[model samples]
Target chain A: MLHTVNKSPFERNSLDACLGLAKAGSAILLIEDGVVGAIKGTTIESKLTETMQSSKIYVLGPDLAARGLSEDKLVDGIQVVDYGGFVDLAAENTAVQSWL
Target chain B: MSEGTIKKFMYVNRKPPYGTVYALESLEVVLIGAAFDQDVSLAFIGDGVYQITKGQSTSDIGMKNFSPTYNALGDYDITKLYVEQESLTERGLSVDDLMDIVYEDEDDDWAEKPSIRVVSRAELADVIAGQDILLNF
Candidate 1:
């Protein structure tokens, strides 16, 4: 399953909930305000790093840029993808789970 | 728009109505998605259970009452509405407090069938596991 989280970790627990339920090898994409969780040194950074060990982590590049965050501010090992990549990821996964 | 393959699509609504437009916007997607003819289901969890509660009056809040839109979902052939039992209980709501959502079954002489299915959280999780796509809002 591909888990897509669009809420900020600071605002809601959607990312935490997704991380808890997502099986190993499942892909996680952060979009919209969810890009906040991908920023390095944020409160969720450590938890995200731990999650990355078991699941592939991605942050929407357009969303990050829209929030004035650069790829350099993202944690190591988290890939940045555009809308096309988002579509491709959804197609590649058997299911898309939107964590809200 | 793909043909010959029908994937299970589940829309997970976890937000309450009129908070930030997530609930209303999600409903619009569900309405439009009915044309795809895929197996679609709606799961109401957390605050989302409030979306279907009876006697919603947005007049005081000055927002258009979209709660009735859920009643129209049956007409669009989007009838599988799942309400998480725990969510309703936590909010002190019962099935009787929800709108009567029903659809006409063409296979059975167009008899009216209730569309809402109240299920435990565990059962809902099982339903989620079986889905091919989950749209969260």
Candidate 2:
């Protein structure tokens, strides 16, 4: 399944949605202001990491690089995906759900 | 599974790149989709057009200007990049001032290949209906 999560407030209510829905073969695509969760060392990353422990959760690389967050700034385990990769992921999943 | 049967998604970008991270982040999701061989399209509307303005150098902001990577869309098998015509004029940008990439038009041979389409603001309805899915960034 494909879950499109773009809400910027990932640490609050939305976090649960992201975690609960992600399952084997599922992926979370973080868009919009949600890229803030891409930061590695923050408190939220720990939770995000645990929530997505068995799933593929992606943060837009272009969004991160555009906003000035670099690969170095990204905490461990967070993958910075490029535009091309995003399309491929969307194609692979059987379902695409957006958590606006 | 049939290739064309899958959902093709277009990201509606309406926010500025910095104040909000939607523009950049959405691009990431698109990449993921592409990795899975999905069809993805991108449209810039409102402040999101700010993402492709010319002469964007984010060095002083302590970050890299992502506008250049827009050129790399082809490398990732991502085409169908669209820019709203109304947004261009509102932002004081003419198509001539925009980034150098494939422009999608009905006459173009884009149907034969992965490509980007430049649409007018008025044409968004068609774009919305044409997609199997719609994502707003």
Candidate 3:
């Protein structure tokens, strides 16, 4: 399954809930305001890094760019997927879960 | 429309009404998407359950009460509105707290049918997994 989180971690617990509930081997794609969670130095950075052990983490490239976040600033191991990549991820996974 | 061409689109709403513009903007997108004649469904999770709650009076807040607009969804041929059961329970709310939103089933001689389906968190996950497109708010 593919899980998508579109809310800021600082604002809502959507990212936490998703990280907690998502099974291992699932793909997580962050988009919209949710890209803030992808930053390297934030408080949630450690949790993201820990979760990356089991789940594949991804942040939408356009959403990060829109928020003025460059690829270099993202947490290590977090892959940046573009719009086409987003569609591919959706198609590849059996389901797309959105944490709004 | 060909059955194969029509895709499953689910609009996920997890924000509170009046606090932000997300709930309203999501509703507008749902309405606009209805014109495309695709299989569209709406899921209200977490704080989003407040959006369809009954007796919403925004007179003091000075914001337009758009909760009633959900009732009009049936008229647009978009009636699948799923509310997460666990979200309501966590918020100390029940099915009765929600507004009465019903749609007329054309196949059944226009009989009135309930639109708001209170589903479990697990059930809601399956619903989410079934969608081809997801719009989060």
Candidate 4:
């Protein structure tokens, strides 16, 4: 399954909930306010890195741009996906669960 | 407008009702967009599932209680509504908790067809992938 998290991990537990339920090999995409979690050296970075050991992690490139976060600031191993990439991820995964 | 172009438009609703304007705004956009003669579908993910729940009485909240407006979607030729099964499960809701919105199918002797499809996350993902445009709320 593909899990999309659109809430800030600091303000809401939606991202944590998504990370908990997302199974191994699932793809997780961070978009909108959730992009904040993609930053490196943050409290959630370790958790994201840990999850990366099993599943793929992606952040919407445009959302990062909108938030003035450069690709270099994202945690290592996390791929950046454009809107089209977002569509591709949805197509590649079996299912998608959005964490609001 | 292209002479004969009809795109697949999907409205992704992920917010709860009343708390914010996203749900209502998405619905209004869907209704307005229906006039374009395109294949339009709606997906209720996360708290979006709450927007279509039945027996929503906003009398005390001083809200419009626009849940009933979902029924009008069928009349507007907007019938495909995908409700994420996991979102509802986490929220302790079932299909029974949602309004029974239906539309008359012209191809099947006007048979009544249900608009809501309770879909697994994977199934909903497939639906999302097939869309030409995804409007998020």
Candidate 5:
């Protein structure tokens, strides 16, 4: 499994690089500005839903609500996680990728 | 620091919630870290401060702004959120103006909400050292 982390407003290079390597079963964590991706009706979300449909997406707790966003904001897919859970996600996935 | 016990991963959050794709992409990277089970932590500083702003409607951008997913973090377990005190003041903002997520309040409100810790650049280095991995987005 691939592990990904993002914390920017929305950098194409950040998501593209990670998504390119994703192989169906992967985890993506949203941090800081990265968690803002959890919001619905954003190009990033649609692209993720379209291309990275098979991957398991997660957003940092503080990052998500910090921006006043919830899991419901995302499409019908994409999973959300917290900081503690982020630690676990990093520990579980085999290969880790950090997209800036 | 044990053998494969603590896989520290530090992510840098430095951007606004809109006008760019860095923020969204960063989230995907963090989740990927969790899938790999790397103890992940994200530090927000600089322009990234606007990430926690409330009420985002990205419909105009022809996409869904998934900011609300931050609340679902409890599920994927990507916790560790830090903010630089300097950044807030430099950007002319306070914790109150930020989103309603867990934070270490500088004022110490001690509410049931999540705790957001405020720190300096030097302290940030200390936290970074504790991590086995660092990912700057």
Candidate 6:
């Protein structure tokens, strides 16, 4: 399954909640304000790094740019994708779970 | 569509309308997704129950009132609308306070049937467990 988290970790615990319920091998795509978690040197950076060990982590490219975050600011190994890539992830996965 | 497999898609609306754009944008996604001919369902829980409340007038708020769009879901063959009973009661709302949404069933000779199903929180949990895809807003 592909889990999309749209809330910022600073505003809510949705990312942690999603990580708790997401199974191994499931993909996590951060969009909207959720891209804040992908920034390097943030408090959640280590948590996101640990999460990538069990599941692939992705951040929406447009959302990142919209927030004025450059690609280099993202944590290592966090893949960035566009809207088409978002659609492709949904099609590739058997299901999608969005954590608002 | 194609002979490809169809997955159960559920849109979970947990926020109220107007205060944020999530509710409206979620509706747009549902409308666009209707073209895929997938098994789609809308689940209203928490503040989401307010989205379908009747007498919604956004004229004073300077925003286009999109509440009526829920009425058009049946036409798109996206008629599985579930309202969590607990959520409504907590907000002091009843089914009577919601919009009257119905669909014409061709199998039943075009007879009109209610599209919204009021379910208990437990029942809604079961419904969530059965969904192949869940889009939360």
Tell me, by DockQ, which candidate is best.
5
TM-scores (chain A) of the candidates = 0.98, 0.83, 0.98, 0.98, 0.79, 0.98
Number of clashing pairs, model 2?
35
Listed models, DockQ each? 0.02, 0.05, 0.02, 0.02, 0.09, 0.02
Per-candidate fnat, comma-separated = 0.00, 0.08, 0.00, 0.00, 0.21, 0.00
Tell me candidate 3's interface RMSD: 13.8
Write candidate 5's Cα lDDT for B85-108 as tens digits.
Answer: 777665445676565665333344
TM-score of every candidate: 0.58, 0.50, 0.58, 0.59, 0.51, 0.58
Candidate 2 vs candidate 6: which has greater DockQ?
2
lDDT for each residue of candidate 2 in B1-137, tens digit (9 for 90 to 100): 34546678777877767655676787777766676666777888755665665555454445546677776677666677787877655433456545566433345554444344568766877877889878877
> What is the RMSD, in Å, between candidate 6 and the native fold over all Cα?
15.4
**Which is superior by lDDT, 2 or 3?**
3
- lDDT winner between candidates 2 and 4: 4
| Tens digit of per-residue lDDT, candidate 1, span B42-109 | 99987677578766655433567788788888788888999998876654456876788888887889
Candidate 2 ranges beyond 4 A from true positions: A1-100, B1-4, B102-116
- Candidate with the larger TM-score of 1 and 5: 1
The models' CA-based lDDT, in order, is 0.82, 0.65, 0.83, 0.82, 0.65, 0.83
Score residue B64 of candidate 1 by CA lDDT.
Answer: 74
The CA root-mean-square deviation of candidate 5, after full C-alpha superposition on the true structure, stands at 16.0
Cα lDDT of model 2 overall?
A: 0.65
Q: Can you write out model 1's per-residue Cα lDDT over A11-97, one digit (the tens) per residue?
A: 589999999999999999998667757877655678888988999999887665543356776889999998899999999999999
Where does model 5 exceed 4 Å of error? A1-100, B1-3, B103-115
Worst 10 residues of 1 chain B by lDDT: B54-63
Report the CAPRI category for model 1: incorrect
